[model samples]
Target: MSLLINIQYMPYVLAAIVVILITFRLWKWKRSLNYWRDRNVSGPTPVLYFGNTLTALFKPFVYTEMEWYKKYGRIYGVYGLVRPALTVAEPALVKQILVKEFHKFRNRMPETD
Candidate 1:
């Protein structure tokens, strides 16, 4: 009898769990969308899950990048599947990051035999 009651409540528990998971995912997506905006970076808007990936699907990657460069200027942010990425078009900034900031961006790989 106790087992029968547990089985009857199982579906409700499963449904509640699913609803919670969906809500969390949507909240995370919304938060991720605001990442660059919070930092005052400007760029194209992204869709819920696809981000700017769908743009690249229909257009050549290089042309898409060029369009963004022209529209957003020397610095912009883009989303690669909900992950925000910064693009620096200015040569001087790139040089600064590569040379002056090399320590901050050093590769972190574990040594192995």
Candidate 2:
């Protein structure tokens, strides 16, 4: 026995794969929504796979953070897809660093290893 394959059906296979991918993405979105709801931290409703903003159509930093500070009142929370993010309004901490001649400064993460 021999089997024959038709290239015409390839489009259907591709479409099915696309549909599956979209469905899985939606599932992850819904899961994130529920997680936020449980936390009770208020935020804007997400736009399907856009995650609360039109990041795809418009770049994330299209408008400077200063503009956001004006609208969101200097401080508001924003999420990147499924990740949680915080926008700070004021920098309450002020530390002065003085370097004389050959002083080197090292940058480190707040989470300290």
Candidate 3:
């Protein structure tokens, strides 16, 4: 019967689905790792998947930035989880980016109550 045939192939179908999901996850991880590279920016080396999670969990962002500032200088990029963030320590450049060009860079997060 058709039902018996499907039952026999069910395990193979499930395995194929699992393989596709794993491939998608690896693709996303690779894309995230390449974000700063595409922008020609560099920061501290990231741990696979976590991406600066150790310092983010232990130290305040400002403290972490301070340490990275000393190491990588004023302009560098960091990964907060899988997302890339640029940290600009220079006051003038920060003002220009955040204030002067505020309209150009819109918020990505949805507004919440």
Candidate 4:
């Protein structure tokens, strides 16, 4: 009967919806991550939904900065959400990027406006 068809497909329909939502979320996360990767020097693989860090939100680990340097060298990127942070080598590069010409990269983030 028609009832049998609907009942049999109910689980499949729910599974499909869940799959779609998970896929969408992953796609968005990757897109945001890639924006930094393209500009970054390079680094290790990012954890799924966890990112390149194991640190909690808004909390900087005592040796987190050193960890990045030790693992990825003085040049690499750490991503959390939309942040595209770069850990640069060469103090001159830092001066050039941060102080000498701060205006060129004023905001730590990009805005849609």
Candidate 5:
């Protein structure tokens, strides 16, 4: 009798777990969407899950980047599959990161055996 009762309630429990997972996924997606906006950065809007990758599929990557550069200016944010990427088009900032801040950005790659 106890086993039967548990089996009868299994579907409800599974449904509740599915609902919780979906809600958590949506909350995370919403947070990712606002990542750049919270930092006062501007760029093209991203779609759920895909981000801005779809734009590249429809247009040439170089042309797409150029269009974004013209629209968003030297510094803009882009999403690559839910991760936010910062593009620095300004030469001075690029030099600062590559030269003056070389020590700080030097550990970008992970060491491997």
Candidate 6:
């Protein structure tokens, strides 16, 4: 046996797929809201969409890092346009990641390696 569907329903199917994709993205975004809180890290409150991108852009990146470090202590969290990012102020940890274990980087710069 064979089955066939009307061509007129194609648009509806496509629209449903789009809706599903959008809904999934929104759900994922909302689910990430508690990431830092769950981890016990603290940082500045984020704005609607820009997050810390604008502050990082206008002022020197180090200044922003310092501000968050002063406020939140050795380790803190920030958002880069809704994406959670972690900042570590510990020099030893930074040295370990940049030098001792550089090979573990997923996207290591070709010039650096």
| All candidates: CA RMSD (Å) | 4.6, 9.1, 3.3, 5.5, 3.7, 4.8
lDDT of residue 74 for candidate 6 = 85
> lDDT of candidate 4?
0.72
For each candidate, what TM-score against the reference? 0.86, 0.42, 0.82, 0.59, 0.86, 0.60
Alpha carbon lDDT of each predicted model: 0.90, 0.57, 0.82, 0.72, 0.90, 0.76
Ten residues in sequence with the least summed lDDT for candidate 6: 104-113
Cα lDDT tens digits, model 5, 1-113, are 99999999999999999999999999899799888989999999998888899999998989999999999999999998898888889999999988899888754434346
Candidate 3, residues 39-95: lDDT per residue as tens digits? 888788776688887787887877888889999888998876777777788999978
Question: What is the Cα-based lDDT of residue 85 in candidate 4?
Answer: 64
Error at 50, model 3, angstroms: 1.1
Question: What local lDDT score does residue 81 receive in model 1, on the 0 to 100 scale?
Answer: 87
Q: On residues 31-101, what C-alpha lDDT tens digit does candidate 6 reach at each position?
A: 67557877888888776456678897788988888888888898788887777877777999878878988
- Model 6 per-residue lDDT at 27: 71
lDDT string for model 1 (1-113, tens) is 99999999999999999999999999999899889999999999999888889999998989999999999999999998898888889999989977999798665333356
lDDT of 1: 0.90
Q: Please give the distance, in angstroms, between residue 72's alpha carbon in candidate 5 and its true position after superposition.
A: 0.8
Deviating ranges (above 4 Å) for candidate 4: 1-18, 55-60, 109-113
lDDT of 4 by residue, 1-113 (tens): 99999999999999999999999988888777776567756775566666766564456764676666788876787766445566687688888888888888766655344
Give me the displacement of residue 11 in model 3, in angstroms: 1.5
**RMSD from true fold, candidate 4:** 5.5
Question: Ten residues in a row with the worst lDDT in model 5?
Answer: 104-113
Better of 3 and 4 by lDDT: 3
- TM-score for predicted model 4 compared with the true structure: 0.59
